[model samples]
Target: MSAVTDNLGLFFGGYLRSLSICLWALVGSLVLGVLVAACRVSPVPPLRAFGAFWVTTFRNTPLSVVLFFCAFGLPELGINRSFFFFGVLGLVLYTSAFVCEAVRSGINSVSAGQAEAARSIGLNFSQGLRYVVLPQALRTVVPPLGSVIIAMFKNSAVVGAFGVGGDLWSTGQTLTSARGLETLPVFVGIAFFYLMITLPAGAILQIVERKVAIAR
Candidate 1:
């Protein structure tokens, strides 16, 4: 009991810190994903090429490699890490690549008639997207996007490798090493911590989807 109490602070703090990083990663990825999706859908060939290239590059590369490059490799080029910004940046960019594909598929699921109708109403491309296409497309994509968010949350745990302190996975490693507890228990704790976040978020998304469906 004393052992658990002693480590509770570390466990909770690490979870919170990791959650923070995950939240930033979620927002950053969503933004970048939307931009990439827009580029992929744009009429401009160059924009589509750029988006495709980015998606393929990040998708092919392991995320840990991306983190390593940002955390370790960048300093070689005089880029410095200040408070794990590089780790967050890498996670965001890497996760965004996948999220982009999710969102692009979502946008594609929306009927082309929506765009045409908006254009008939005098909306420009951006305006049509903002008012008509994105809203409907977002509704269609909620379930998949929710999965992406959950996945990103889980993946953010990897930032611990970059020496970013105070993440659940890193804390688990520290506790396991110091306490020499059974590996199973430590991993169980880590898995439970992740489930606590992801399960509820997924449920919420489902609820939203149901509501959207009912409204339609």
Candidate 2:
């Protein structure tokens, strides 16, 4: 507590950085996830195959490996960028696979009659998905998407370990290792900051789920 109190600015700074990582990853993953999910459910065989490949490759890989590749591997190909960019990229790439699956399952939960009806109305595949199917699918997937986001937020901590400075975990390390603070208090502070994000997130998700439940 004293460690956190003494370094309030550092702790809060770390919290903001971590929050930024999660927020950016959330948007990126959601957009990418929906696209991948669309590909998974598309009538075209190649699109489905590509979607399956994407889900299989990314879902099977560890987050650490993904981040390592973005952090180190990408640089080797002469695509150097800030650690923050790479960190968010890794998070989005990894999380989007799970998000895709969640969304795909939601799409599948939709009645076959729905698509047939869309065709009955002369709507093309993409048009049906855009106007009719996807809207319903997104509503159904809200709860699972919330869980995916929470997992992504936790994973953002690992990004800090890979030299993305000013995140909570990195701040903890700096405090205990560099500033001679006790590890317990430093990490306790970090945990508190994490909960600050997660608890409200969980509550908000619960509300969203309830709002969508009957409609879904």
Candidate 3:
């Protein structure tokens, strides 16, 4: 308890930063994912190819490798920056691929007739996707999308290994080292802290999904 209480402000503050990183990363991932998913399902060959390329490249690559590249590569390109920015960037670029696939799966679930009927009504691919396909696709995908967001939130811990100071993981280490405390309590606290974030997010998604389903 002392290990956490000794620096109460530090723990809570770092937790906030971690949440902020996750929030920013989630937004970035969803935007990029939707675009990539669009390309994957697009009628144009090149568009589909580009989307496939994106999914393959990111999905296959390890997050640590991408993080190292961003953390190191940015400086080589003369964009000296903090680990927080790089961490968020790495999370977004890597997780967006999974988001793309989940969304693509949802798009796939929509009946072929939906799209065909849409086309018969003079709706083009992009317009039909926006007005018709996306609405239904989103309903099916909410749960999986929520899971992805939670996974990405947990992934923020990886950045702590790289010495990003204002995150929960690093803060845990900071408290442990500075207070000369045992590691177990610190880690357990960290785990509970993460659960606090993920559980509520999952609940919110479920509530929103249920509401949407009821409305539809």
Against the reference, the lDDT scores of all candidates come to 0.84, 0.93, 0.89
Off by over 4 Å in 1: 1-5, 179-182
Question: How do the residues 9-68 of candidate 1 rate in per-residue lDDT, one tens digit apiece?
Answer: 877888788888988888899999999988888878999999999999999999999998
TM-score of each predicted structure versus truth: 0.91, 0.97, 0.94
Q: Order the candidates by lDDT, highest first — what do you get?
A: 2, 3, 1
Q: CA shift at 117, candidate 2, in angstroms?
A: 1.3
Q: Pairing residues by index, what is the TM-score of model 3? A: 0.94
Candidate closest to the true structure, highest TM-score = 2
lDDT tens readout by residue for model 3, 85-202: 8888988999999999999999999999999989999999999999999889988888889889889988988977776777788888777787667898788778777787888988
- Which tens-of-lDDT digit does each residue in 158-202 have in candidate 2? 999999999998999999998888999899999999998888889
Which pairs of residues have clashing backbones in candidate 1? none
Worst 10 residues of 1 by lDDT: 1-10
